[model samples]
Target: MRDAEEARTQPLGPQGRLGRGSVAPVLQLLSLALFTVVLVVILVKVSKVPSYQERRQEKQKIDKEMSQLKTGIAGLCRPCPWDWTLFQRNCYFFSQSKRNWADSVIACQDMGAQLVVIKSVEEQNFLQLNAKNKGPTWMGLSDLKKEGVWQWVDGSHLWFSLSNNWLPGEPNNDGDEDCAEFRGDGWNDGKCRVEKFWICKEPAASCSSP
Candidate 1:
């Protein structure tokens, strides 16, 4: 019984100490591997942060430049010439002097434009409003080529019939009335040689710096 107690109380031998020391080395290796994995993950995340910030800043700068370009274009844009009114994409000039239809055409040509051609109700209304308190005005329309067929100075056929806006009983061909005129808000057939104020039209100038 004494021998048994001595064996149980004895210190561990070299073999047991070697076994315990080996286990400690293995545990240390495992801990080092885990730390390396964590460090790699942190480095990868930190590397992406600057790249993401750079991309965001570049996108913001591009957007700011685009906005500035649009503002510059708007600032440079001009709508009409001096003494002219702007409507849609065209510029208009109302004459203070009277001229016959043929002479009016020549005058508009000299100004690098043509007699006004009414394309829609809006344009017609605009012309009428501006011509208020003025006498009859020559239009770009005439049936000189064929008495029954009206055409604009640009040679485009008048698609809609005169009944849409003509004065009552007009174009009676009364006394060789081949040219067209605007009196008040309605159109009328008048002699081509009659003197009248007119309107000239041209495309608006390009947007540019003065």
Candidate 2:
């Protein structure tokens, strides 16, 4: 009887515990699982940091390249050769020597350009300003193909209806006066063989580097 009473009052082993299993071992396993979950979360966050930094740096590099490209394009748009003047997308060369209109055309062709063609009031104004105090200069206009039918050097018909830079009472077709010249801020028909200073124009060359 004493032995039976002592066995009932003794502490139970793991396999003989209440309900499903031992509470201490279950608690320890739960704590270990929690610790593992926290460690995994911390490792995931740490791994993402480098990825975020790399993405940010890539974006900044792209932005910098874009900025440089914009600056390069702006530089490319205004390329002009040395000793030449830029106007819009074209370049102009003012001669320091005099030549006949025909010889002037040949000279410009040799230089990879052509005699200047007046296309706008602004261009005419610019030419006039540059011609200040200078003597009459040969232009690219002529009615050599047919009298009273003027044309530019490029074969485009002169739009007399839209605009005519001819001086008043001029182009009278007087005595083989087919070529044009700029004088006193206006234009006049003149003999092609007459020598005068000239202007040459051509498209601006593109820059090789950005």
Candidate 3:
């Protein structure tokens, strides 16, 4: 027995080859590599996220597209905007604020619409009924350009013989009244300098009612 201490050969592991000590190091290296790969994947995914400004811009673009879709040819199924009334396939807005005739015209134009255009007795009646509750309101009819020759905001001539929705003693052209106002009696030419609530009219989305 030559040196019993060295005679007891090191205990063998699986297959009695490299032993358990060598296996542990290999497993550790594999685990480290796997962890590194996972970390790298996570970093790359985080880097791909959009920035705050980029995300905001994208949202703004989507919002613009949605607005166009709501007002364009595809909007046939959509309804009138809020605070507007729908009648005869048209949308009418009754303003709560008061403004002079010129300013009222500007206000309506700013909203992508014009002052109410009363084309028929039916339209006049509709406006009259709606304005009954509200105070006196402004109409699109005016003779500012040429006295006694009334024209609509759309530049169409007003044919009194056709609709004839005017007060008996109105349009007297009293005190240089060029603008028109709608009252419970009928329409009357009023001073453009005087402020009054106005009505706005536009084509409603062509939605078929269920």
Candidate 4:
């Protein structure tokens, strides 16, 4: 009995010590691996956070620039030749030489604008009042696509009753004249081939400062 108990106790001493020693190494290694995994995950997240922040900042700057552009019309870096012409949030070009309606439209498009499309009653009045000296300038209004039906070159409807700005019997589609011209009172039908002054317009909001 004494010998068996001693044998059993001897086995327990070595086995317990070995198990404890082996378990400590395994736990240490497992902890190190877990810490490495956690560190790698944190590093990846931190790196991506900066990229997201940078993109957000860039978007804010773009929004600010757009707002600034909206509030103010681009200022003149150079003097405009049409001294009497009034322009707001836009650039205007009065044709120096005469051209047919089609040619004038093409020229305006080449300059990155269509013929002038008046946006408001005030704008129409302004154009008309100034156009007397301009001698009936070609406007954006035309029946080029569909005869007898008027439409702005920009594809907007001309609600005549809103501004009520039109000459007597205006847009009569008289004869072969399909093009429209702006005068002091309002508009008049005219021949496209007829030589007259023309207006080119570009939005000021879109112009970048030099």
Which ranges in model 4 have alpha carbons more than 4 Å from their true place? 1-86, 161-163, 205-210
lDDT of candidates 1 onward, in order: 0.87, 0.84, 0.86, 0.77
For this target, which candidate reaches the highest TM-score against the unseen true structure? 3
Reference-based TM-score of each model: 0.61, 0.60, 0.61, 0.55
State which candidate, 1 or 4, has the greater lDDT. 1
Could you arrange the candidates by TM-score from highest to lowest? 3, 1, 2, 4
Best-to-worst order by lDDT is 1, 3, 2, 4
How much is 97 displaced in model 3, in angstroms?
A: 0.8
Off by over 4 Å in 1: 1-77, 161-163, 208-210
lDDT of 3 by residue, 136-179 (tens): 89999899899899999999998756446777887799899999
Query: Over the stretch 1-210, how does candidate 4's per-residue lDDT look in tens digits?
Result: 999888877755654556666788899999999999999999999887768779999999999999888765555443333422337766677777778788888888997878988887767766787677667789888878889777888898777653366677766777888988876667888999998888888765443465
- In model 1, what are the clashing residue pairs, if there are any? none
Question: Which runs of model 2 end up more than 4 angstroms from their true locations?
Answer: 1-78, 207-209
- Give, for candidate 2, the lowest lDDT window spanning 10 residues: 14-23
